[model samples]
Every structure is written in C-alpha cells, then in structure tokens.
Target: MAPRNKEQEAEVLSWIFEVLGEKVPSGQYEDILKDGIVLCKLINKIAPGSVKKIQERGTNFQLMENVQRFQAAIKKYGVPEEEIFQTADLFERRNIPQVTLCLYCLGRITQKHPEYTGPGLGPKMADKNERTFTEEQLRAHEGELNLQMGFNKGASQSGHGGFGNSRHM
Candidate 1:
C-alpha cells in the first residue's frame, strides 16, 4: 500500500461532508467510508438518481455493491476509469491514498458539470482549449525536426569503450 496523506484524506472527507450537508466528524476515514453509504450519497448529490437503490444495512456483499454503483455512476459522470478506486481499496483498507485520489478526481471532474456549484475539492479543472489547423500548416512542419527531440549535433559514441569500460585520457 502507498503512504497515506492525512491532510488530503481530511480534505476529501470535509468535501464529502460538505456536499452531503453534514458536519465533519473527527473519526477514522476508512471506517467512516467503509460502508460506501457516504460515497453513494456524495455521488448522488452531484448527479441525482445516479444510484437507484443504496443498501442502507445489509451483508458485506450488499455494501460493496454500493461502492460498485458509485464507481459506475462516477464513470458515467465523466470520471476516468483509471482514476476510480476499487471496492477493496476503500472497504478492505487496501489503499487509502488511492481512495483519497479517487475522491479528489471526483471533485475535480465536477467542473465538467456546470450545474454543480457546490464546494469543490482540489484545484479548479482547466477548460479544454482546442486549436484547429489547416492542412498546409500541418504539412509545412512535416519534414522539420522538432527541437524537443534534442539536437545530437553529430555527437556519437564511436571512440567510447564497450559497455562499462572507463575511457583513459
């Protein structure tokens, strides 16, 4: 498991509580979110009716289903698949940092929905700036080598010893 950041986890918790219109409580982050109820509530708050039925009290499998539902809803709401955390990450306490990262991504993705005017989590997401180019403009740079590719300037390792041998002056 990766090292967990207390500050980031606190921030995500605060954001979740704020979105749910509940007061932030001083408690274990994983324990608070283990049941996945808060997660479902958070996503539903962002996107109403995203999760049709949230199992309030049930077996472990039912609770895990809530996490899965939240995952699917977030993916449908534009959160990237790679950014979403697995059920075990939150439930089994496998990787809390990943869970925090997933929440942060969910908060950042809220910018995609203009209707979401609630409290945000991390830095504001940048809007897409697309620039179109004409065919002539693209062809002009086809034969030209990009400077970012690095200029070797005819330098080569012709005199260098094979492998790790030291070169004597």
Candidate 2:
C-alpha cells in the first residue's frame, strides 16, 4: 500500500475531528473515546486520539452507537422523525409565494400554475350548470338560429356563433 500523503491525512483527520466534536459532549473524555470507537468502526481504520487501531473489525459499532443515540434522543424529546420531517415539508409547501399572471395563453388575464400556458376552454367549461340539451336538439337549434339570422345568405362575413374555426387556427 502507498504511504498516506500529509494533506490527505490532515483532511481525513479534520473530518473525523469535526464529527467527533459534534457527537461528543465537551470535557467528557469517555464520550470522546466512544466517538473515536465509532469513527474507527466507520472507516475501518485507526481510531482518533488512540495510539493503536481498534481490533474489532467488520462490526457496525458506529451504526449501533447511532441507533442508541437516536433511541435516547427520542426518549428524552417528544418529537419523532416523521413529525420533524412532515413539519419541515409542510413549512416549505405553505411558504411558497403566490405569483401574478400577466397575459394568459388564451390572450386573457387569468391565474394558473407557473409552468403551463396554452389555449384551453378553462375551468368554466368543466362546471356542470345542470342545463340539459341533446346533441341533435343543439344542432337543430343552431341551424334554425343561423337560418333565421341570414347567415347562409352570405350577407354577413362573420359566421353564426357555435364552436367556430378558432380550433383550426
């Protein structure tokens, strides 16, 4: 095996020390030792603050310590992991700022989600107004109205109202 470079060793030591500092209580030597054992278990390497490497190889003492710590923390505190994560996620969801829309895709002013913009009949078309008219009745009514309005006489360049040719355009 190649000898460890000074810079790489320093970086790894710094990381281990940082993790130890976070995990261990200040002025507690035994807790510091436990942290070192956990770190050694983590990397399968030399324990920090020890003259010798720990001999218990392949055992997950680091993960075991973490589990013990987690259990202790939950016992001491009233909060669970699900509670914490759900609270954080709900905060992020509710904190999203509302935006104003300028011109809609249908060339009208409307509110919409940020990403989508296209020609649509919009929500008014989706609402059931309880007005019942069969297709045949609607067609006959429309044809009568068009004939009465002299739409077929070629007098008016604009056609009688229905769906119109805007969909084709």
Error (Å) of candidate 1 at residue 75 is 1.0
Model 1 segments more than 4 A misplaced = 132-169
Write one digit per residue (lDDT tens) for candidate 1, span 1-169.
Answer: 6799999988899999999999987779998999889999999999999999999999999999999999999999999999999899989998889999999999999987899989998998887899999999989987988867986778877889898899978
Steric overlap count per candidate = 0, 0
The lDDT leader among the candidates is 1
Clashing pairs in 1: none
Each prediction's whole-model lDDT (CA): 0.92, 0.32
lDDT of 2 by residue, 1-169 (tens): 1332434333333444543344433443223323334434322221122223443334455434432442233323332333222211112232111100100111121122223233322233233458888888778855345555555765654554556545333
- What TM-score number comes out for model 2? 0.17
